[model samples]
Target chain A: MNAVIYALFIVLPYVSLVVLIGGSTYRVLRWATTPKGGGGLYLGLYRLVNRAGQRSYLSAVGHILARMLAFHTIPKNSYGRDYGTWLSVFLFHWGVFLLIAFHLHLWMPWLRVGAEAMYVMGMATGTIALGAGLFLLARRVGLRRIYGLALNALDDYVAITWVVLIIALGLAMRALAPPGLFGEAVAWATGLSSLHPEPPPAFPLFYAHVLAVELFMIYLPFSKMAHPFTFPVNPVLYGKFEDVDEVRRRVEEELGW
Target chain B: MVSVRKVTYGRGGRDILEESPMYGEWRREFEGRGSVHVRIKEETDEGTLKAIGVTEMQRIDRGASPAERKRFFASRVAEMARENRAFRHHMDACVHCGLCIDKCPEYLGTRDPTNSPVGRADLVRRIYRRLNKASDGLLGRDVDDKDLARFLEEVDLDRIWTYYYQCTECRRCSVYCPMGIDQGEITRAVRQIFVEMGMIPEFNARTIRGVYETGNNMYIKKEAAQNVLDFVLDDMRQETGRDFKAAMDAERADALLLPSSTDFFSNIGTLKGEIAIMDELGLDWTLDSRALEVANFGLFEDEAHLKYIGDNYVNAALRRGVKMVVFGECGHGWRAFKNYVAPRLEAMGVQAISITQLTAWALRKGRLRVDKKVDAVVTYHDPCNLARAGDLIEEPRFVLRSVVKELRERVHNREKTLCCGAGGGLLTDELMPLRVWAGWPSVYDSLRTGAQYMVAPCSIDKAQFPAVIQYHKAPIKFKGVSDFVYAAMYGLDVDKIA
Candidate 1:
């Protein structure tokens, strides 16, 4: 029974993550390959990257890092009166970052002592983050403009459900489970290289938490979260200058301006 | 190449007056006469407009508005808004921050916030929003005739006209706008509104009428255009004398050169240099005497006029059988040809390239040579139309730096470059003071570089720069790229360099 539970917890989540990431990458590649006229896409991309490169490399890297840490790319002022929704977004993003760092400890050998302390901090932050995210979900449903702009069937529900489930299971495994069970299970799994030690039978909530997180990662890049990967390029492309008159004149004089 | 025969007219419908010297002179002779109609025909040999006899008399009601005038005028706005997403988006997205205050030439020059593009756009937006709300919700009860009248009165028609006309529809403000609100689109829309209100500027009105009457905006007869070319070439010979020729309607030419009519009448130095540069480069280029204009006033009006002006260029190109067509350095003209005309032509099955793009191509192809040593510390001015509307910011800098030596580029160059105060057809007697005021910011910005000379590859800037520099008492000389290139290549033996 314990062996079955452990397989379901770790193996299922790993499979789901691989499938989601691989599938989304394929789709993005396909979309990029679609043929278009006028070289707008290529030129746009070149202009954007080149402009960003024109700025000192240190400045570009610093900007990107600051945005990642603070979510500074999103404007702070909402057109509508919804302070709670904004706060919820802020809390949730910060919490997600902390939680991801805590999870990485399981894979990173050097972070064992620090990871334990971080896990406790992350759990505390994650609880508040989960609550804030729930508040956002409720606000989206209540607010007409937000509901209209933000809510689509697959996006709104699939994302919300995944986040809520992960939070609930994580909380259960951390607070309600027998003392030392969570850490012991992680240790046992890490030590047993080939044996694949079974999860403690009583820690079923831990299995559910792992599964939820894996599902979330799979869906992330395909949805609105993908903005992180794309939005930074806009300013760079828009900043470059291409003098059409000079280009037109050269073309006229040489090829036919 | 094209010829027009002068036919005279009298007060009576068919009575002949006297034979005139030229068709344009004949047309002028009959101006304010009872009525005169020009008969235009295309000459096969030269592929130019051949004139038949002119007829006169029978004055129709000069002030009569078109049938369904209100609906017609309303529909024009509706159509323009419907087609131009940029115009609609800019109008809708305005936050009224008044940040565009410094960016507007009129407002910066005059220190009047009301003249800024954002302020003008806000007026339009408020009116549009009010109309929309009233029509949709209150069943038109929310807005009454009295309220409409009051709104109209508060709009400051003269100030609006002055400021809107003052804008060259350059997109400098749009560059800094957080919402991507193009002031050009806003100004164009405002101009349309003025046309509806029967408040068109006199000079602009005349130019539009000229475009309608003659194919070109200046109303230059084919003979007169040819004569002007001859006059300029003779002047060039006296000045530089290297056998410079202004080829008109030459068959199978590599390029169709469209010099602004203003360049011919004024700024003859720039014109001479442009011709000389082309000659020095050994390029196969020709000018068209029949359609000797790059400035298209139709951009300020309805699509019909836009199409009409664009068709003239396309027709000229097709008739001459040129491989490519190049426009002169006029801001709105470059914008019209590149952003509006070229795309429209492609849609109409007449594909052509823009002058700037062609020039950049030539540089890339090594057909044109530039000595960077000759051009040092050169700073470029971004004509708003080309910078914002046409998305042309870098090619000029590249071309200039490639030719001139030790070019020190301005930091706020390209998209952030300031506009010369004389855009938007505002360089008239009435707007002279306003032009000086509006041009102050640009003067300050350019003067910071302490460069000896400023290079603007725009014909309007070339015309406006002297007055602006003179008004401000700034010690900076303005030169077009062609002038600089020509001057740099003056004594360099082409064979030895090659």
Candidate 2:
């Protein structure tokens, strides 16, 4: 393999993995240590599933999942144009999530996803993601052009524009890849994970897709893309986890109100 | 308060900042965010909380020269950006999605870009982002030195002070954040950092200090408080021909009333209703002088003070050995009690209930009789804190329906409520227009009900709605639910309220 190809595929993947893992770790730990002062008891992970609280921990989890993941928090005042914003947001996020989920077999070849099934699901998800990505880009730009609203010159443009590019590139690869191209890519993926140096597909689209994915991973920790990982810091609900009375009885008796 | 963003920042009010090229465009974008937006005060006033021995007040640049102040601000910003987790997470998490724009009353009222929740969060977020990028530069990442400097230049002591203070910490924007990032928590963290540097708004500082110094938020001494309570009791006696007695700081009682200081000074009608209900129920209840405040100003600043004020309740409950603690008609205060202090009280086997809850229970039990409907059409406004955080949406309405001739409902009620803008200690002379602008939606919504009287269980609403109603020249009268209850108990018109 050429040095450029080797750096992009082998060296780049390892480097991206290191930065992503390290940066995400730093973010999670940093958020966890931030001084939360509302007198929470710093309950253990058990508290998450602990059924003892006034509002069941599991119930709180369900509520928060419905809120964050399910996009249940429609802005109270998002009546007219916001419905469009909501639709674009909903389509783009869920499309990207499913696209990524379907791509999981590349990292786990033993799943044995048939090529026909892969082609069908990949085309569906990729088409959806690509369309939603273009729509989001247009909406972010169009709203600013027409309405002069939520126009972040830097963060918003960079974040959305990058997603659109990544999705567009992935769709191109998924639609037009030659036979055995994906097999080579899968061999490269498994080999890379197992520390063998099999070359990725020689196709330019395959190289472009992998490079973009790696760079995206590196950028993930730097940008607000880290939101999903850092969500524990901003948990959906402030529901109490412990049965306060029971804990209080067991706790060291402080004789103040 | 669906105010359009005006094109000019030449407003004559103190709400408009003096022309500065640095944030001039930002100012123009938010020109009409509220009726006016507040400029962060350049100097501290008489009411600024002093370093009163109990709290350690750090003066970063209080008595420093300009150069020293600059250095101090830089150091504090860097330290907080790295050490404060809440600020870091929020600054990193917000994607500047404009969903928060229409949601924030400050932004909607003023149309100021910085008044927007995302805008305000970004004002701090930009500086902190630069700070983070600078730190990231240590790892060999390319960062623009001039860009960081420019972003840092956009925020200074005054800019940070002005924009952040505009947020009432209402959490209205947080409700819609898909990420669940609570901007209220971010505001409190930033405010606490400023407060540590002896930079606090006089109104918030004074209120907090008053709670610390005296038992109540208004710092009315025991004699003055007692006189007001006595006068209220006497007024009730003459009107209703029923002798209602209330004790202050009773050694023991079945329940303790954590009344807002306004109950004694500004809204005695609420006091009268509370007294009559507790008496009618035939339960032993006492209003403790040491813990009469229902406004927890500590929530606007820091957790230490939140705990400090909350301890007054714990100590009051322990001292009285009360089986229940009945919180008064205060919005944020009840929220603080419910989310933070109530569970602690419940843990100790003492039931924590609101006055609205108690009155609703009493009325529901058919134990308290309403002789006649209040001679008016009434509308109810849900205080943001109580409805959103305190689980108190229907109780006040239940009590209102029990007494009013006709109850009209506003478009925005219950958890999806608008803020009084006067909340989060924003009820100051400086931000009067901002308050009015923030109060516009609710005031007008209440007016739309064609109700002669508009009532809310929140003390802040009772305090804010009157001024807002007067400003808009809306003929709607604003009162507390307790006031209507008092009038209904005696078959009196709303005008009978003194």
Candidate 3:
């Protein structure tokens, strides 16, 4: 029983890491080899203005990060504009993002904060993630009709359910004891990289959260969850609303204006 | 069973426009049409296909049953992914975020979920997921022969024909998508796959063949086109007493004007306006039979045809020894030229400019003068290609504003412009109802503005708006920007002359 528990907690993480890295690398390589217009598919972006090269890298990075962080595109869509899916999506995405950052503090000691500050931050982020995640799940299932949409595939249902489960389990751990599993979690999480893998605490909520997260990491490369990894980093412009004159001026300079 | 003209989209004769519960009505008719939309394979010219050097795939064996035909396509789907990288990336990237659903004009017009961008993408994405074994069967299963057979059942001729053609390939949804997954690209790739398997719509297939044989989609013979131009110049001389003239490839010309064949046959006013503007400015320009068609219909099908059609224009421009190739009124044709073909020209130390740009630039420089603003209140419609895709948002409006007394802006203008339902080769007699409904938003917006004239610098728009206005009983008249310029230049009241 102990060996089995050890396998789930320790052996499974490296296996998950290998699957995640291997799967993503395979997808990228598969994409790299394919021909787009008898040329490589990865040959940068579809340049609209002939001479308008890439904007400064810093600005593009900031612009891409802000657009992704704010979930600004949702509001532009009709359902986002009319039915308020934008706000719901914004809350859900950020809440989960902050919650993950908080979890990362255990793995990276440099990100650690004061115990009292960490307690307050942990609880706040957990409640937000759980609340928003549940709403997202409901929108996928029960509230779909209200949004004038139907769930697309079995993948849609499973994706939302998995996310909500992780958030709910994490929230439960935070609420039930608040400070019970920190040392054990830190020891186990930090030790995963070391030769001697440490054991996790015998707490159901903590075990469940770790289990859900590890399984999700393994599943990420195969599913649509792989989108965010490439999307934000990809060179293709997404909702960079420059004034028409500004775009025109930038292009004209290159066109011998 | 309601007549398409009388299908008012749920509004009283002069009431404010709102969406009527007409989507359900449309859904029945569209689905009922199904694979009947697939024209006979005779439309696909094998010789033209070879001339274009199209990447061939396994054609459907006619003796096999329909089920066997789909099975043949099942194997070829993977080959398509291998041949086109953009196809694979777009297929991989769609997250099925239902935000893009209503962004489609077809879905908004028809209210069919499957006709929506995400919905259309999801259909092919399901089979793609299983085919590539990208997703394991937590919900998505691994593909064995039995799984492949079961999965291929989901990808049918009717589903591919109806849903993919329903899109106008506007890129409206792509602009709004956070990840920029263009459903238009996916639709083209799917169309290419089916086209290889000896299936394509009559309208798209016939038009491509027309371009190859006659140097224009309309198949207007050179002699017939010359006679029409002469007759129009004669009419201009008689009416306004202007010495407007067009010649076939003048020696030492600085630029070549490739007029849309539609302008030669249908929108003669546009040709007259272009000739008048260039003549009044004393810009040296000539027309040639080799590059007569300004619009490239090849863009509608796939890249093979796009390059083939584009080569015809490039060769003509090179032969003329002109420094510039000026495109007259066309939508996606301008996009193909500006984005794809312009770079090639620029590399050769030649430039490609739209007539709108040329006129707008000349006007700004005070080199070309409009003698008078035509006595008309005009609303400008931005064709989809010229706006977001082509980066020509302001140039046409600048030209229109110079020629018309007042330029009224539509609610959705510039980057947010609505598509005239007939772009991306969805302009066919059989798809006329779909076109009318898809064009409702543009017509409704124009009507609300109470503009006397609706001006778009697109041949497709010039052709489409007439049908949209007549069906919706809209009072507004449709004309190209050039018509207004010509009217303004001659001090002719467009209402009387046009």
Top candidate, metric DockQ: 3
Question: What is each predicted model's overall lDDT from 0 to 1?
Answer: 0.54, 0.70, 0.70
Per-residue lDDT value at B357 in model 1: 45
Model 2 earns a TM-score of 0.85
* Native-interface RMSD of candidate 2: 8.5
Model 1 alpha-carbon drift over 4 Å, by segment: A1-257, B1-84, B134-163, B235-241, B281-283, B344-351, B354-360, B370-377, B492-498
Docking class of 3: acceptable
Q: How well is candidate 1 docked (DockQ)?
A: 0.03
Real A-B contacts recovered, model 1 = 0.01
- lDDT of candidate 2 over A153-241, digit per residue (tens): 56578878888888888889878888887778888988888899898889888788778889988887767778777566654253544
Q: DockQ score of candidate 3?
A: 0.32
lDDT of 1 at A160: 63
Per-prediction TM-score to the true structure, in the order listed: 0.58, 0.85, 0.87
Model 1 chain B: ten consecutive residues of lowest lDDT: B49-58
TM-score of chain B of 3: 0.88
Where model 3 places Cα greater than 4 Å from the true spot, the runs are: A39-63, A77-80, A107-116, A142-151, A178-180, A193-196, A232-257, B1-58, B61-64, B136-142
Model 2 chain A — which ten-residue stretch has the worst lDDT? A42-51
